[model samples]
Target: MTELKKQISASLRKDLEAGELILPSLPEVAMKIQEEVKKKSSTAHSIAKVIMLDPGLTAHFLKVANSPLYRTQNSVQGLPEAIGLIGINSVLNMALTYTMRTMFVNTEGPWKKVLIHQWNEATELAAIVAVLADYLPNFNSDHMMVAAMLQNIGALPLINHLQHFPGLEQEEVETLVEENATKAGLALVKLWGLGKSFEDVIKARHDWMYESTPELDTTDLITIARYHYMKDKQRLEDCPPTSEIAAFRHLEELDFTAEMSMQWIDSAREKIRAIKRMLCM
Candidate 1:
């Protein structure tokens, strides 16, 4: 590693070791949505009211509710209708995804370009994962999409920190992220009090060898989505063949062949495009 790389890595390590890393927190609207979701007595209208407070989130929620992902017969006309159609859990997840995405929109720095690229890649993977969830059992497409979007979230703070070091090249910062993102991400997730699912998925997202009793879990779905993203970007050499991964191995029980996976994604190209547009990517 170069001197700059060493400095970046050491600083991150010291922070992590000392539990002083400044992780990002969820937006207030997202927190309110989560609080509403947790209240067993909360009604759809109540959640809708919280969502409506943020006009941008309200618009995105309505757009996603009417998108091909939900496939509602009629367009969702308002926040209440959108909540009723998409469910409180899904609305909470969408709101979180939207809010987390806004945190990455840096406008006046060299890091802005890198942050934009990362956000686009994240949204793309998220869309693909949401579509792919339709094929799996007991999986919430919206929730999985949110998880996929957050897979590399640890990199955001690290990249933000790198802005202070002018001599560090983008490549070096990316390399550091590749090596330490999971650790940083887990810390962030824990700090935010996200559920165990978020913690598990973020912790094991990059571990191709991860296996669970059910064989098919959020981590597996994320791995598959990530594999497709890398393959589409011609970065396959950096990862193993999708079929060789533990998640893919378990998915084989469902007779999920590589060709089938590709065909499914190919068929949903238009849907994916629609989701990206709704996400403002």
Candidate 2:
């Protein structure tokens, strides 16, 4: 590693150890939606009231509600209607995902481009996970989607830290991020109070062989989604065949055959395009 990278890595490790890293805060709108969803009495209308506080999120919600992913025949022209169509939990997940996008927006330097690339990959993986989750009986698609989006979030601060130094190659920075993102990501997830399951997902995402005692979980879903993302990007050397991937093997219980996996990726391509368009807007 370069001296600058060494310094940045050390600093990041120190901050993570001491709980001093300035992790991104959950947007107020997401906080409100999260709080509202936890209550038994909460309804779509109540969540819609909270969502209205953020006009951008409200607009995005409407767009997503009418997206092909939702398959809503009627246009969702209002927040209440959008929320009602998408469900309370889904609204909460979408709002949180939408709000989190702001954290990756950097205005200056090549890092902005890097952030955009990372964000794009994250969203694609999340979209695939959301679709795959639907075929599994007990999986929570919304939560899996959110977890996929966040799996690489730790790379943001690390990349930002590296930007302060001169004479560093983008490849070097990316290598550092791939090495350290999980630790930083888990810490950030805990700091955001997103829950232990999410933290586990972040920590376990790179573990292809990870299998939950009871059944498949977010880690398995993300592993498979990431493999597809790599394959879609034509990173053939980086991705193994479906049969060789542990997540695919563990997915046998869900009747996830190799042919079905291919079909899932083919179907997800369109949804991923639509989702990326909506989120990027």
Candidate 3:
């Protein structure tokens, strides 16, 4: 197993350095939405026109606009209205949110089951952070949601090659995922033109005891989310408590605490559940 791990790791790094690895392009809808958003002339109605092209995305947009997470006195009814309810900045995030789920669900090849696990893990982390972001005034929850989803995106480039390996154990697969995720993620994020937020998330996702700055950042939030993700899976048997995490200390300046974290998660259970359902569907 160790030999296979080394062999696979070496091959992947060679391909990465040589720019031979195939990375996924952002979905057309997401790309189009991003372009449209950069235009100072863009409006909810115009954004609606772009989203209306995909029936699935259109439906998901409406559902999100009406979900307990965003809905208020009036239920969102149409694409333009949905875009209005969520704000233009979040429309691209919404488009991304839908397409990522679609990509994960609609995957092909021998590693379908393994890929699905990765999909669920990433999105679940996204959901946790989105809810947690509600506690902070400066951060955007939708943006944080997307950041968490992409934190482990490094694992994606390897899934294709892993399918070719015979008798790869689950433990071996998990090990390889940990070994190459950050490097592979950086390559994909750059290729896709995902920008700085993604670069930061991939770079810091594994810094379990990171202490770079006393100030809180998007990286710190995802770190906290990653810890929660591990804890929820009972994978923290050997890990330290949340209070010990450097990120948690910064969170205190935001009036967030280990106790507040649990309470907020519990209070916003419906919103998180809604997001998970939307992403998986």
Candidate 4:
């Protein structure tokens, strides 16, 4: 690593060790839904019932269902209709994604804009990952979709902390932001008691291969998700020179090639437009 990257990483480790990062309390509804899902007794319908109570969430869910990205039977008028259109797992993922988006909106200043751009990039890549995962053999697109949606969550608390600490220069602070976001995100997944597999996906996002052993599918989704985020060049940078991306780059080893990748890129653009139109983004 370059001296600057090493310095930033070391500093982030110290700050994280000192507990200076200001990780957000998980959204209440997301917590509730997670708790309900963990209750082996809870049915999808039960979870769906609770989610319907949040009008903003409910409206967003319906809007997502009606988006041109999803070919639905018809316009969804209610929570059940929306859930039916997208399936239980998809609804769950969408709820979590939407909740995360709301939290990012609560930040202010340059960091707020930076994080918003990151979230938007993540969402776009996630949508493409979701679409491609559907076609990739042995892939669980649902898990991939949710994981991709949340991969950058580590950055939020780091930015929050930067805002609270006024002494750092903008450029220097941004380096810390990247390092801590990765570290804090990994820490939050562990602190929040997510599945080991989920934790592995978040932590190994830049790795060359999926170390969690679930399947290479979800890792591929994360790979592309991060790639698209980096491609935006506003919130982040060009894709990291890491083994994880190289693994994704070897898609030509599969039936797919560089040319085919463009389809995903194009589809993601269209999906973003459709979502923006629906949500007035």
Q: Note the Cα lDDT for every prediction shown.
A: 0.80, 0.76, 0.81, 0.66
Put down candidate 1 lDDT per residue, 1-281, tens digits, no spaces: 79878977888889877877777777888888888899999988988888888898888888888887786667788788888888876877888777777787743466666767767888898888988898778999889888987777887777777778878787876777777778888888888788888888887766877764567788888888888888889998889876678888777878787677778899998988888777744
- Per-residue lDDT of candidate 3, residues 1-281 (tens digit): 67887788788788878888777788888889989998999999998898888999999889888875686897778788888889998988788778778877776776677778888888788888988888877988878888888876776777766768866776787777777778788888897787877788888867777755678888888898888778778898756777778888898887778778878777887878777886664
Worst 10 residues of 4 by lDDT: 235-244
Q: What local lDDT does model 1 show for residue 224?
A: 86
Give the local distance difference test score of model 2: 0.76
Worst 10 residues of 2 by lDDT: 105-114
What would the per-residue lDDT of candidate 4 be over residues 1-281, giving only the tens digit for each residue? 45655655676688788776556776777777777766777765787778877878878787777876566676677777677777665655677767777877767865666677667766665666766666567766556666875677887877776675555566666667565665788787776666666676677655545445433556555775556555555543445543335545556557675446657766567665554454323
* TM-scores for candidates 1 onward, in order: 0.94, 0.90, 0.91, 0.79
Instruction: Give Cα distance to truth, residue 32, candidate 3, Å.
Output: 1.3
lDDT (Cα, 0-100) at 215 in candidate 3: 83
Please tell me which model should have the higher TM-score, number 2 or number 4. Answer: 2
Q: Which residue ranges in model 1 land beyond 4 Å of their true spot?
A: 106-108, 212-214
Model 3 regions more than 4 Å off: 211-213
In candidate 2, how many Å is residue 88 off? 1.2
Shift of residue 232 alpha carbon in model 4, Å: 6.6
Record all residue pairs in model 4 with backbone atoms less than 3 Å apart, i.e. clashing: 154-185, 207-244, 208-243, 208-244
- Give the candidate order by descending lDDT: 3, 1, 2, 4
Cα distance off (Å), candidate 2, residue 50:
1.3
